[model samples]
Target chain A: MNETATQTVVRLDRVGKTYGSGESAVHAVEDVSLELEPGKFFILMGPSGSGKTTLLMLMGCLLRPTSGVVYLFDRKVSGLGEAELPRVRRDNVGFIFQGFNLFPALTALENVEATLNLKGLRGEAARAKARDLLGHIGLAKRLHHLPEDLSGGEKQRVAVARALAGNPPIILADEPTGQLDSKTGRLIVEVLKDLAHNEGRLIFMVSHDTRILGLADRIFTIDDGHLKD
Target chain B: MVSIARKNLFHDKVRLAVALAGITFAVVLITVQVGVYLAFLANASVLIDHTEADIWITAHGLENFDFGRAFSEKKLYEVEEVPGVLWAEKYFLAFGYWKTPTGSQETVQMIGFDPETLVGAPWDIVRGNPQDVKYFNSIFYDEAETNRLGDVPIGGETEINNHRVRVVGITRGAKSFIQSPYIFTSFKNALNLSYVSKGNTVYILVKVAPGASVEAVKQRLKETVKDVDVYTSREFSKKTRDYWMINTGTGVALLSIALMGVVIGTVIVANTIYTSTTEHLKEYGTLKAVGASNWHLYKIILEQAVINSVLGFGLGMFVSYWVIQVMKRGNLQVLLPWPILAGVYVTTLLMCLGSSLLSIYKVTKIDPALVFKS
Candidate 1:
């Protein structure tokens, strides 16, 4: 990989999103333009209803742009047909939620293994690969333990391992540490920064947590749907 | 994937147990009722079961097993002279009631057969002798009905059609539909009570000679016996069963409706499982967040439904067998064949899968980002 000129991995051009209709319509995101490079930790900050989550969803390709275009690997994803978007999201994006999202019934390893299974892996091969990732995240002992059995920090680590398991270029985390205590939150952020700086992942986290601001290489704000510098 | 579906079911012990219990109840209800229906159909042909005769020569217009038209015994001689010749016995089947001395009335299927041929006597008699039935106007009552009547004395006379009839023997399982206690008498006594003349009987039973094919014998008898129908024992039984289950709408209709109860139970299985998935929507969201697709989620849900169906079906069949056994002791008309039980199980599985389909859809449709937002 060429260090500085690795090319922009996430770019949004004049993207607008309007929800509802007539007098009831709401413009959730409006005319937002941005670019995200590899090996950087970025923060999308806003108060509630400021469309921070909406913008993040749009950037993750989990939601379509109501207007304009989204370029990831220079494919112009927004203009692509409906059928092609899910594949793009599956292959290129990883998502983390505030609740430390994990299927409660599955073991930590099984939870990570679900990724490859969706990517069409099955049997001992999926389990073996999941085990390797869990080992990397220092969760080998808790590999067979379900989410309820793991501590908040342990769960977040498992979630992180799951995001990195598929080797997706972009990891979109929505308030990834909001449920954890301050110390655990800091540890969670540290792991996320390692994904961005060391592993050359583009980590875009949406949050209002002030403690997270200094850790980000670039900070973008969405206030009432428009980008705020 | 199937392992995951199973794991999800066991994640909550109480939920799984409750769902299993519902399914079990549905299974038992379906199997037992269907068993009863089948038994009723078989029991209606008990006369055919007891007769050693291969062909029954009944009136030409007869449509019922026990209560068809009676005719002159001359038809017996006609059937006797047919090619592949077989001997014939005259028998009478009539419905009447016997009054206990205390005035408690028990209905009966009064059977009269020639004493010389001794055709279609009770297969098992617990008291006295079959020869005792030779006592003109003497009758045989089943052991169950006898006990039900507070154990009446063996030599006592019960009033039949207002005439004194001696109870010469106690039999077992010779009873008729719920109300009818069975009684066997001599042909002379039957004609006397039925007010019929000599050389006239309700039916003529024909048995082929040892070397003759039974079907050929039946065909010959039919050809020789004019205006009269002669059928093999199996054909006669089928005709009788069909009379009850098919020609008449009563038994078959009731049984088929009862079987649909299983279908209803399967629907409940689907609803509850689907409802549970909705209750755990966020978990699916989490699955999606971790990179699981809708298709992956759907596969497990379908597998979970199948597991529930198979378990429910197995438990139900066991319940049905026990029920059939108990009914047999009650001497109820309830049959539980392997084929019918298998059909019930397969139907139950389809129902289980049908019910769980919606749950699978709901789980698969969940957006992974919902977990992150919440």
Candidate 2:
């Protein structure tokens, strides 16, 4: 890997997020600071309502912090306006959800192509790139199938392909394998692992499934809005 | 991206059909109301438009063509003496009760003109020669008036104002604006059948000689003729049309109905689009989470609205065409000029675009983090 490709891409400075105010407020994340670099698979393990998802959202620029700051690719993003956040998110961050969240109306290939289009790739070029991503994840034969028509494993693989579109520097997965069987979940983790190690991407996943913890380069745990390494 | 707007709209066929139906109903309602309005105005001036006269001399302040006021028959000679006047003829119009053969009485508009001059003769004569009205006690009945006149056949006898007359000619396309049938006859016959006295006429029709200015002739007649309104043929027709449209309740009623159609259409289309957008809130949230901007979502909804309006307008015009054709068979005139058609299309587009505003607002306010929920 090149010297710059292995550098830290995301940094958090005493980040905190609280919902509501006064006596009824609930703190979802609290003063958790960390630096994440490329070419490594990182895992965040937490029980329900433990704020791992909140931390992931903060890093992805989906939620603004109540205190402290966030930086993506060495640039501060915490103070950016709502209108300016989408461009930074589009160019750097790709998210994978537990439910797949593929547009129900779009076929598997089109789901990936839509994301590529958001990144300014269009027409046949978007199509070819989407096909190559899905093919690499072993979904080449299921390109035309809708989400409802695909198996759980196939759907999750398509979601992975979508996250890899536009070659975002960071991939955030929230319980990506939460809905899959053991064998399929392992295969997905392996695919994500290959993306982080070989393609030099920063793969940050939030999950309670400890079976794949052995594969992660680093692991962190969260409890009641606090983080620990 | 893959025509997301089109695919989203076409995905649910039932919703799309309902949306189109609302817009189509509005288009038909507006078109028919305006069509009838235009037809009523056209019929109000039909006599003035079809006449061969270059100028008309009417009693001062005559309201419309149907409501005639009598001026002295001597005004014809005054108009004929104008420098540009080629000739002039006396014409009379008044309402009289006609006793059908079944003894049922119906009101008719009596038109009197000189048969030799044929200055204001009934057009589209279907049965007999127009000149046949020159015979004494002879008149013309429109073919469409058979139901109201008790099916008067050729050579049939009828009584107008207690004066006996024979139907010597059958005319078509002469339906009056006020739902009264027209009775065409010679000036002498009309004088006997109507309440007008001898040597008194309602109007004097004048023709300008070749290469003569009609405006100059009209001005000279206005100056020479006393206590009468002198107008060119176009001015007289416009006056007649405006009288019916502004001075009567019919115009107000039709315009009100058209305005109501627009309001109802906007509400229906807006409701449908808003409901569809709400139902797809999860999908929209997902798009936002995937970095789709607010404008991208708005474009999808706006495209759907435009598609609905275009398709609905086309279907509405097709139905309106058939409706007008059927109304014609019943002797009801509904004009569909090019301007009216183009106006309806533009109105439909604007209406649908306005309706899309509510849906766009709903989609743009969504929370992108909602997609995080399993």
Candidate 3:
């Protein structure tokens, strides 16, 4: 791995998250500290209801940590307001969801272009970049296909292209291959691993697919909101 | 951003059509209701608008043009003598019953003007001449009122206030809001039929000289005339319209119907837009997770609203134009003036944007983190 401690893209210090309140409260994540660096595939392995998704959300700035700080590229974000978090995510983080989460209304190319548009890149330049990214993912011929028309693997690939559209340094994927067949899921994992190794990007993924664990440079397991190295 | 909004709105063709239909229905309802009310107001002052007179002198405390107590004919002479007054003529108006050939009684507003000058006469004569009414007991009846007046054809005979009268000419587009057909005649004939004395008249129609100021002439007429109200033609027309539209319950009724149309339209638009937004809730959540701001989501919804409003407004205007054509064939005046058309367009946009507020709130409050769950 080319990653170093000094090259951390995300740092969580004693982070904790709880849902609901008082006696009915569910502690989704307990006090945990970790650092993610670039140029390596990092796996967050856990069983169901193990708080892996919640921790990913905290790192992605989609949720605020209940008690502790989240640092993205050395800037404290847990204390940021709702309005400020989207900018932090837009500039530094990209998200890939379990169900592919491609916009059903947009074509494959358009789904990727939409993310570029959020970053204020538009017109022919955005279109060209989206086309190139789709081609890079071997989906050049499916550019005009909507989410409903594409296969599960194709949909996830489009989602991946969308995630990389803004060239964000940190890619946070939550079970991106969970809905695909084993063969298709393996292909997706290889593509993500290539992005992490060749492009020097950090691929932080949460998955239950143990088959891809051998490919991870580092791995952490979570059980009932507690993380174990 | 705009492209995404457009694609999303157009993604489901059926939903888009249904939404546009809702907006179009709203536009049509509001525009048609308002158009009909405007037409009603215009009809209330139709005679005043078509008349060539500059000043109208009526009895003191005259409320509207439809009803006025007769003043002395001497008022015409006094009004004619005003410095800026070019000419003044005695004009008479009264409501009397007309006996049809079948002996059925129908109310008619009798308008009497001098045949030679032809001032204050119905200008759109479909058949025959205004001068023909100068013949004794001869009258001009509006052809548009054939349905109500039982076809008083040219040269047909009818009784006005029990006096035999001949329809010498047929006028067009002169129907009144009171649902009373207008009967045009010479000054003497109108007075004779209404049982008014020879020396009395209902109004004195005045014309200002070429170089004279209408306001100056009005002031002179007010000073010269006694126990009479003198008003410029525009002011008198407005008063008549206001009386029919405000004091009478007709205006309130029409306005209330128009307002109801607006409310119903707003509800339909709100419901349709809210439904569309809810259907796309998951997609919106995904967009947010991909780093889109609340403002971005709001822009998308607003764009959808604007598209729906503009297209719906265009369709509504097209439909209203056809409706007006049909109304004209039936002899009903429906005026869709450009200003009113513009007003309706702006109103449609406002209605659509206002309707999207709930959907905007719902979309903005969506949790972006939900995209993570399977």
Candidate 4:
């Protein structure tokens, strides 16, 4: 890798986030400092209750760092107001969850279109964007299918399409393939890898699959609220 | 945004159907009670309205409708002779109970009108005609009393207060006070039967000359007759209706019932919308995480609530007006006044908005980190 290409898109400095207070307080993320650069396929691995998820959320500007600073594109995030975070999430960051996934009631095309529509696109424009995303994700034919009708792989693909609908610069995906079998999980990883590779987007994911780790440009292991070297 | 809301409403049409059913049921009760009350008010003024006369000359006191009377029935001829008076008809009203041969007694309002003048008759007969008008001494009653008075053959006699009378014809839909049928008879027939003073009646109903205002005639009559009160048809009809509207406890009773319906509708809308959003809490979070601004998600959920409110309102109005086939601003009593309808819509919309705000809790407090490790 060229040293000049490691320019940081996301940076966390001495970030510590604690829930509760005093003796009973629990530190979810402690003194975590990391940099995620553009076009980097980064993986955060951890057991349950580890700070890995917290770190990604901090990078995505969803959660504020407790004691230090976080910067997205050189803009200070830890000091951002509550109202400002929504714009940050909408225009710059994308997220994927594991269990509570796509809005189950909306059709696949609607799910992708809803993201663009939320960003203030009109109905026709949003639909066009959503259809293009679905077509790119190989779900063009299943545009009208609801989540219940979609298999695990198809649902994840819809989720990915939804994430990219707004063309956010950073995609922060939770274990998007956690619920899928090995073959489907590999397919999801390939799609995400393509987004990072061809599109030059920063793709940060929390995954349990070590098989996909080989595809990551960088992988960090986290355990019990601390990063493991 | 609105389109999203409408599509979402269509998405779960079954749930929408269920919610709309609740609103419709409430409207049924509301319209029925309101319609019946208004129908009663309309029936109260039927005798005066059917007279189609311009001016009423009653005793100075004008205490109760049945007990009011002028000093003379001759006053009818005098009013007819007055300048600009086209004609005058003597009208009498009384309240008495009819004890049938079956020993069942019903209280009724008795109306006496002139057959020659054709001033007050069973004009709006639904089932029968006033062919009985030829029999001056016989009585014609509305059909509602037919069940009690028996299908009176034209020649059959019934004892009404120990006096023998011939039954003429059964009126179609005539009920005064909405409980008892009004009994219509000739001027002298009702006078002697109800023990009214000889050659004297309760009031004089006068029809003025063309291009004459009823209020002007009323002012002229009251000026000419010092010891009597003159009222226009609309004025006296409203007076009689107000008498019953206040005395019979209809205002408080129907208002309370309608208020309850509105409250119930608000609660149902609020709870249903709030619960629906609660179920979609995580879904909202996922949307927020995926390039959805707080306002954006809020617009969607709020659109859903407003859609529910509008749908419920449209259905409620339909069921309310369709039941009695009554128009809103017509003579019908189920008045959906502008304020009431507006209040309902505004409050319902607020309820929906308030409930959907609960879903914003999910959006704001949602830790995108919670689902990180899956």
* Candidate 4: regions farther than 4 A off: A1-7, A21-25, A123-125, A222-229, B1-14, B48-90, B96-107, B114-135, B138-175, B197-200, B203-239, B309-374
lDDT of 2 at A219: 99
**Least accurate stretch of 10 residues (summed lDDT) in model 1 chain A?**
A1-10
Model 2 misplaced stretches (Cα beyond 4 Å): A1-4, A18-27, A47-50, A81-83, A178-187, B52-55, B78-87, B97-106, B123-129, B137-173, B206-235
Tens digits of lDDT, candidate 3, A48-80: 898999999999998998998999877899999
- Chain A (candidate 1) TM-score to true chain A: 0.95
Segments of candidate 1 deviating more than 4 angstroms: A1-5, A79-86, B49-63, B75-89, B96-106, B113-197, B205-239, B246-260, B289-293, B364-369
Each prediction's DockQ against the real complex:
0.37, 0.52, 0.58, 0.45
Ranking by TM-score: 3, 2, 1, 4
**Fnat of candidates, each listed:** 0.41, 0.42, 0.59, 0.59
Query: What is candidate 4's CA lDDT for residue A29?
Result: 87
- Over B1-374, each residue of candidate 3 has an lDDT whose tens digit, in order, gives 43776887788888778777777777777777788789889889999999989999989999999997898897777787789888888888999999977789999999999999898888898899899888998999887777667787787888889899998988878889777889999988899999777899998888899999999999877877788999999999999999988998777887777677667767777887788788778778877876788989899889888988888888888887787788777767676789998998898999889989999999978876668866
TM-scores for chain A over all candidates: 0.95, 0.98, 0.96, 0.95
What's model 2's TM-score? 0.87
Alpha-carbon runs more than 4 Å astray in model 3: A1-6, A20-26, B52-55, B60-62, B71-88, B96-106, B124-129, B146-173, B195-197, B206-235
For each candidate in turn, the TM-score is 0.82, 0.87, 0.89, 0.78
The 10-residue segment of model 1 chain B with minimum total lDDT is B284-293
Q: What is the TM-score of chain B in candidate 2?
A: 0.92
